[model samples]
Target: MGVTGIGGFFFRAKDPKALAAWYAEHLGVGAGPYGHWDTQAGPSVFSPFAADTDYFAADRQWMLNLRAEGLDDLCAALRAAGIEVITQADWDMPGVGRFARIHDPEGNAIELWEPAG
Candidate 1:
């Protein structure tokens, strides 16, 4: 059979422990060795952007997009926690989803998506 889904996402972090903690605390992402998350079944996107795409920061090589539910509530929580969350009206697609952008402590771009119901 072909590959089922993404197995893992490994990246280098300037401060792995701190970064992991941040993800776990704010986004509820699992952290530390043996950490794992059981995500809700849904659509996943695997597309490559053009070399000169302006959708995200040019300095970054890759941006992480995560599927989410309750977009408004999550955005509000993130804001309450003192994290800067970016939202643009134009980024929403009527049938696709709503989008928000946030960066890790290390400046990694993360796109949070809540698909339209």
Candidate 2:
């Protein structure tokens, strides 16, 4: 059978517990052994970029793109929590969506996307 959707995302973290906590506290991502997030139904992008791509940091092997709603408020909350969020005018595609970027405590790149309505 064909794959249905992404089941999980596993990664290495210098401090797994702390990192999990950060994700839970800031982005509302689930943490702990039984933590699970129930996401809304929407489009999910799966693409491989060129080796020299500058879409994200070169040192990092992957960037996490998450679908979001009420992006403006989320960005504001993130900033208020002392987390830096990066946004660019050109990053917003006409019919695609608006985007913002942030990093975890370990410097992994994460892109926040709010699809065009």
Candidate 3:
């Protein structure tokens, strides 16, 4: 049988509990013991960038992109919480979607994507 979907994404964290808490609080991820999150059924992107690509931070090896809805409200909430959210006009595509960037407490680059409705 072919693979259905991503099973998990594991990574090293300096403070596992704190990091987990941060994800759950800010992005509503990694909530339970198994870090399982129920996501809406939709398209998921799977692509790798070149080593020298500046699409994300060069210092980091990977960036996390999350699918979202009601991005305007979410961006406002994050801003009100004092988190820096980055958006640029060029990053948006006509048929693809809108994009925003933010870093976690440990400076991991995260992309929030709101697909066209």
Per lDDT, the best of the predicted structures is 2
Which digits, one per residue and each the tens of the lDDT, describe model 2 over residues 1-117? 998888888899999889889999999887545658888889999999999999999897899999999999999999999999999999999999999999999999989999999
At residue 84, candidate 3 shows an lDDT of: 99
Q: Is candidate 1 or candidate 3 better by TM-score?
A: 3
For each candidate in turn, the TM-score is: 0.95, 0.96, 0.96
lDDT against the true structure, per candidate, is 0.90, 0.93, 0.91
Residue 86, candidate 3: C-alpha displacement in angstroms: 0.3
lDDT of 2: 0.93
Task: State in Å the error of residue 3, model 3.
Answer: 0.9
- Which residue window of length 10 is worst by lDDT in model 1? 30-39
For model 3, the stretches where C-alpha displacement exceeds 4 angstroms are none
- The best-first sequence of candidates by TM-score reads 3, 2, 1
Name the better of 1 and 2 by lDDT.
2
Backbone clashes under 3 angstroms, per model: 0, 0, 0
| TM-score between model 2 and native | 0.96
Candidate 2 weakest lDDT stretch, 10 residues:
30-39
Taking every candidate in turn, the Cα RMSD to the unseen true structure, in Å, is 1.2, 1.1, 0.9
- For candidate 1, give the lDDT: 0.90
